[model samples]
Target: MAVVFDKPTLLQRIAPIFQGFDGPLVFAILLLACAGLMTMYSVGFDHGSRFASHGRNMMLAAGVLFVVSQVPPQRLMALAVPMYVVGVALLLAVFLFGIQKKGAQRWLNVGVVIQPSELMKVAMPLMLAWWFQRREGQLKPLDFVVAGLLLAIPAALILKQPDLGTTLLVVASGLAVIFFAGLSWKLIIPPVLLGMVGVVTLIAMEPQWCAPDVDWRVLHEYQRQRVCTLLDPFKDPLGKGFHIIQGMIAIGSGGVWGKGFMQGTQTHLEFIPERTTDFIFAAFSEEFGLVGTLALMAAFLFLLIRGLIIAMEAPTLFSRLVAAAMTANFFVYAFVNMGMVSGILPVVGVPLPFISYGGTAMVTLGVCLGILMSVAKSKRLMQS
Candidate 1:
C-alpha cells in the first residue's frame, strides 16, 4: 500500500515565520509608521526628495524588522558577544582614522561611512545582557562591577568623539540592562541624588558659569555653549539660540487644533531649523497642533507599555534585559528630542524615533522592534 503525502503550500511554508507575533505591538508600530509617513510628507514636500527617500527608508526598515524577527532569542544571545567586540573594535578604528564632519570624528569609512557610536546603542545592551545571563542564578557585586567596566570603556571612547547624544543613549541602554538584572536600589540612589544636586547648583550659578571667559574643563567648548544656550536661549537669540527659539515658536503656533497639514507658517516660511531632522517634532507640532501631539505621544506610550509587558513575559534573562533596555532606548530618544525642541534640554542632536529623517536611525529602530517581536514570539511559542 503506497501512500503519498501533500506538499506544503507557500502560505503554509511561511506561516511559522508570522506565527506568535504580538498583535497589539504590531498595531502600535503600524500606527506610528503611518503617522511618520504623513508627517514626513507634510514637512518634506518642498524639501527636495525627503518624502520619497523617507518612504524608501521605511520600507528598508520594515524588511529589517521582518528578517530580524525570524531569528530566535537563543541566536541573539549567541551573537551578543561578537557583536559587542566588533562594535568596540570599530570604535577604536574610528578613533584612529575616522571621517571628520562638522568638527566631529564620528564616522568610519570601510566601504561606506558608518557611525560606530550608533552600533554601540544596540551592542551595549546586548553585551550587558549576555554578561548577566551568564551568571543568572548566582550574580555578585563583582559581576556588576565587570558590567560597568564593559559599559564605561565604549562610552568613554564615544564621548571622545564628542558625540554626547550617542554617549547618553549608549549609557542609558547599558544602565537599563544593569537595573533590570537585579541591582540593588541601595547602590542606585546616591548617584541619582548627587545628579539632582548638581543640576540645581548649575542652574543657580548659570550666570557665572556661562560667562564668556569661563571655560568648563570637562565639556568641549561647543558643549558648554549648548548648556549655556539652554539656560537662556534669549541670551544669544539669533546665534546659538536660533534653533530652540524657532522650534518653540512653531510648536506654540500650532495651537490646540493645529494649523492643519502643510499650513504651518513657521514650518513653510522656513522659521524652523532642521525642520525634517532633529527638530521634526517642532514641524509635527506646527502642523498637527496639541491634539495631534497628544495622539502621537499616546502611540509612543502604547509601544512602551507593550514592550514592558513583553519583557516581563520573556522566558530568559537575556530576552528580558534586552527587551527592557531597547524599550528604554525608545523612551530616551523621544524624551530627549522633544525636550530639546521645547527648550527644556540642551540641543543634543537626538532624533524623534519614527518621525525623524535618517536612514541609519530608521534601520536601528527596525532592529529594536525586531528584537521586541522576537522576545514576544518566543514567549507565545513556549506557552503554546
Candidate 2:
C-alpha cells in the first residue's frame, strides 16, 4: 500500500468547528450584544463618535470570539502557563517603565500601548485551572496555598499600579477558581468574616478616618476619598460625590418607563461624567428607566445562569473551573459597576461587560466568551 496525504475539503474542514455549539449561550450573548449597541447609540451619540467606535470594537470582539471557539480546550490548557507568564512579565514591565497618565502608571508602550492588567482577567483563571487539573484527584491543602500564592503575585503588582478596578477584577477571577476548586471552608470563612467585619469597622470609624488630615497607610488618597464619599456623598456634594449624586438622579428619573431614547436630561446636559465608559450604565438607566434597566439585568442574569450550567456539564475539571470563573467574572463586572453607579458600593472603575466603551476590555470579554464556547463545545465534539 502506498501512503497518500489528503487535505480536508471545505465543508470537512469547517464543519467540526461549528459542531456542538451552545445555542442558549450564543443567543444570550447576541441579545446582550444587540442591547449594548442600542444602549451605546443612545448614550454615547454625542461623545465624539463613541457610538461608531464602540460598534467597530464590538464587531472586532465578535470576530475574536468566533475564532477562539474553534480552538479545543486541551490546546487552551497547554497555552495557559505561557499566557500567565507573559501577562505577569508585562505587568512587571509596566511597573518599571510604563506609560503614565493622570496619576496612574498602568499602560505599557511595548511597541503599542496596552494595559497588562486586563490580560490577567483571563490568564489568571486559565493558569489556575491548569494548576488544579495537574493536581486532580489527590489534591491537598498545600496545593491550594500554592494556588493562592500564584494568584497573589500578579494581583499585588496590579494593586501597586493603584488600579483598584483591575486589581479587584484579577483577585476576584483568581478567587473564583480557588473557590470552585474545593478549597476548605475553614480557609474561606475567616477571610470572608474579616471582610464583613472590616466593612462594619470602616463604617463605624468613617467620621474620624475620612478626615483630610488622616492618612490611611494602606489606601491611596483617591481610594480613601472614594470610600469616604461612598459613606457620605453629601460631604463633598460638589466634588468627590458629584458622580454618584448625578448617577442616582439619573437612575431615579427613569421611573417605571424610561424618559425615552436620548431624552435623558442628566445625560444630555452633561451632568453625568464618563457617560460612555464606567458611567454608561447610569445613562442607560436614565434613558431606559426601570423597565429597561430590569430587562438588561434579566439578560445578564440569564447569561450568568447559562454559563454556570455549562460549567456544570463540562467534561473535565479544567473546563468546569474555567467556565465557572468566567461566569463569575461577568457577574462581578455587572454588579460592581451597577453598585458603584447606584451609590451602593465605592467606585472602583470596573466597566459593564460587553456594554462599556473600551477596546481592551471588549477584547478581554471576547476572549472569555471564546473560552466559554470552547468549553461547551469540547464535550460534544468528543462524544460525537
Summed backbone clashes in each candidate are 0, 0
Candidate 1 deviant stretches above 4 angstroms: 1-4
Instruction: Tell me which residue pairs clash in candidate 2.
Output: none
Q: Would you estimate the TM-scores of all the predictions?
A: 0.98, 0.95
> What tens digits encode model 2's per-residue C-alpha lDDT throughout 22-95?
99999999999998888889888777798899989998998999999888899999999999999999999999
With candidate 1 superimposed using the best TM-score fit, by how many Å does residue 349's alpha carbon deviate from the native? 0.7
Tens digits of lDDT, candidate 1, 307-348: 999999899999999999999999999999999999999999
Distance (Å) between predicted and true CA of 272, model 2? 1.0
Evaluated with lDDT, which candidate comes out highest?
1
Error of 1 at 372 (Å): 0.9
